[model samples]
Target: MALTTEASRYRPSAIWQLRLSLFMATYVLGASALYPEVFYTSALIYSHKFLVGIPVLFIGGVCCAALIHGRRQPVRYALDLAQGRWRGCLLVLLFFFASLTAFSTYKIAIPSVVPYYADNWLADVDEWLHGMPPWEIVHKLDSNNWSSVVFNSYEVIWFYQWFGTILFVSLWSDEIARIRYLCAAALTLSVLGTVLALALASVGPVYYHHFVGVDRFHGLNAALDRLDHSYMVREPAAYLLKAYQSGRPSLGGGISAMPSMHVAFAVLNAYLLSSINRWLGVLGWTFAALILYGSVFTGWHYAVDGYASIVVVSVIWWTTGRLVRE
Candidate 1:
């Protein structure tokens, strides 16, 4: 959609933008105090990624948008940017990057601060809730062909959706809805991704054996290994394990299992997209469901982690909507 002058006029004040930045700043400071070494190292790593990756992604997004909107819209898009009508969205993005850096840093530090003591408990809870390991239920879908789809959806597609949703809402015409989305997103990452993550620190099913000294999920791992298309899934988990062993902050290095952030963000995206249109809403929710299943199927999380994330994100979405409207 083209950016309109009426939408620009209704853009929320810089205060909302400042709130997001301030929250990130505060989180960074607190986390730095707790683990200065990790905070500084993670900052360096993630800063470089954001610097190189964001421009490439933003340009790609612009190109795609131009193609979708047709040749005539590029001039208007450039003019909108030139006139500073999109400044709020840009500011929101800047703060978002900052928050993400802090979140990643804290995620890496979770094991150092809290240790992985909750995996067995969470696994048992999963068994109790589902009458068997959640992976058992999801693994029923496992096969060479389906594994490829799940692997890409869980890793590659989720990355696009995460950034794509931000760009989508950034360009949305409704200022209030945009602010509400930004608020909810910030809270979800900070509260669910970091704070509660630390409080409920666990290694998840995939890493349960390594962290807890038990091969409880060996069957699950073996099943994944047998799937020809699941190398994408296995490789990253190995990389994270190496990073965890070295005690060095690498890109996407942290490992906290309880309350899967993947599922959390997917749920958040569903809520935000649904507010825009029903069809997009259906697409968002479907993707959310897929990620939820993939989280368990891939052994990245217990079933309850996704369940809790869905509930918590819904509450955050609703609460932020009320707060922004007031």
Candidate 2:
């Protein structure tokens, strides 16, 4: 084929942005119609949590892109970057908001779709493998203060690495092809993971312990209770419990866990980071490993949930890679 500078090649197409925005609009409207309270709550959370970063990163990306492509007068280059990279930044913002909103909406809707808890089957599968759930395997470690610290801190990977990777790819990276791949792969893995989770949703071990009287995971339950008293991880679980008890709409309170999106996103982050830089990829993989272990150790998901998520994300990543090239 042909060679071109990074600034001159592989930018996202307008048609691609148009199609993605259309899908996002449809999802937001449909989700609002189905569950107005959940949609609104999620939107509010998104606005507060992620909206501030958009402008900062967008401007930074435009300046960087302009600097990279600076072959004209300063004012002229700034205007050109505004017309090009700034526009792309806005598109990236739209895609990010849309993807996150859809994810939160589906998380809220999961309980409605699968009303009954299905952890018994998953727990059984774990037992079939080793006669005990994965958390129990780590039960001995929970006694060590550092283990609790690690498990508590491990949850940060979900937000830090996942969102950080998105911003890095969209704003800092010169690889537009990588950005497109991530955009497509994120939606694909999210939708598929939600579908699979909804098919046979479960409240997971900790929730089951508190809500359904499944005493099988007592060791894991105790560890979570201890973490609640000291660690930041307890806050989300507290919110989930309150939402479950009050039956009120809350952001990120739903508890479906058949296939762990935490693990899926971790896998996607690792894959995308690997595509760009080896050291970044290693960091991403380290975070993924922690999340893979944390998903089971904290009783948020069965061991099999993480396993299945890895497989699913791997398939989507491979498929999206090919599609981005084409």
Candidate 3:
């Protein structure tokens, strides 16, 4: 994570670097036009979280840097922040929050717009590809002893990796790399998380029985029920269902599962981190593999969802890299 001399001296053009912000502005406007109530409600909900979460995340990031890199590194980091690095970081955070607001709003609107008709198709595709439902394969490998750990990795660690990568790249001195990462991330969410998800509106395996009125995943659900820490997965799934039913925009609410955003973001993190260094790349990919597995293991997604996400996100990442380099 050492800043290269070229990066330290390089200053990106304001318009070019603010591409994410501009994209988000256009997206927010478009979303508002289509779903004003959902857009505004999501904006309000996420805005509050933005105001409260930013400072806490900033402090936590600094503390972690201090603990990992020692006292002098924190001083240098603070100096960088004061020396105007914060502007870029602030823009990144704004883009991220805006993306979340837009993504969640679209996620909430998916069912109303398209309806959940892809779960059965996705399930069939998963079985066709894997010779059986992926969840069954995942369950076969699952151990009750490690269910909690896997759940936490999928739920809690995913958040940390998601936000932590944003924070890390936001502060990265490499302007081209930073812009590339940010743009790729925004595109991944907008395209894979929103557009394709809406096009292939599916409630995923966990909620398949509930939404589609079929017990297609009964064995998968039963296996989950047998897990020692099934509640970790069940509770959030229940909350999402409740929020969806209530037609309310809650924090981290909404569900569309064709292309797993968790897996997409994980893969995106892997690409960006690998560019920084080998070890980080390894760590990123490992976490991504875990997330891919957990997405099915928790019955939150079909195996094909994760598979499609990896392919689409890779293309998006590669395309964004070329754009930034240009």
Off by over 4 Å in 3: 1-15, 66-77, 80-83
Give lDDT tens digits, candidate 2, residues 116-143.
5678888889889877667877655665
The best candidate by lDDT is 3
**What is the TM-score ranking, best to worst?**
3, 1, 2
Instruction: Give the lDDT of residue 241 in candidate 3.
Output: 92
State candidate 1's TM-score.
0.91
Candidate 1 error regions (>4 Å): 1-15, 70-73, 79-86
What is the RMSD, in Å, between candidate 1 and the native fold over all Cα? 3.7
Tens digits of per-residue lDDT, candidate 1, 153-205, equal 99999998998888766656567777788889889998999989999999898
lDDT of 3 by residue, 1-326 (tens): 45785554454534456666778788877888888898888889889988998877766665565566655577776655545556766777887887788888888889888878888878888889989888877777778877887899998999988888888776666777877887888788889988899899998888888888988888988898888889999899999999988988888889888899999999999998898889989999999999999999998998999999999999998898776776
Candidate 2 has a TM-score of: 0.81
TM-score of each: 0.91, 0.81, 0.92
Question: For model 3, what is the error of residue 54's alpha carbon versus the real structure, in angstroms, after optimal superposition?
Answer: 0.3
lDDT of 1 at 318: 90
Candidate 1 clashing pairs?
Answer: none
C-alpha positional error of residue 110 in candidate 1 after TM-score superposition, expressed in Å: 1.3
Q: In model 2, where do residues sit more than 4 Å from their true spots?
A: 1-19, 56-84, 143-145, 172-176, 224-230
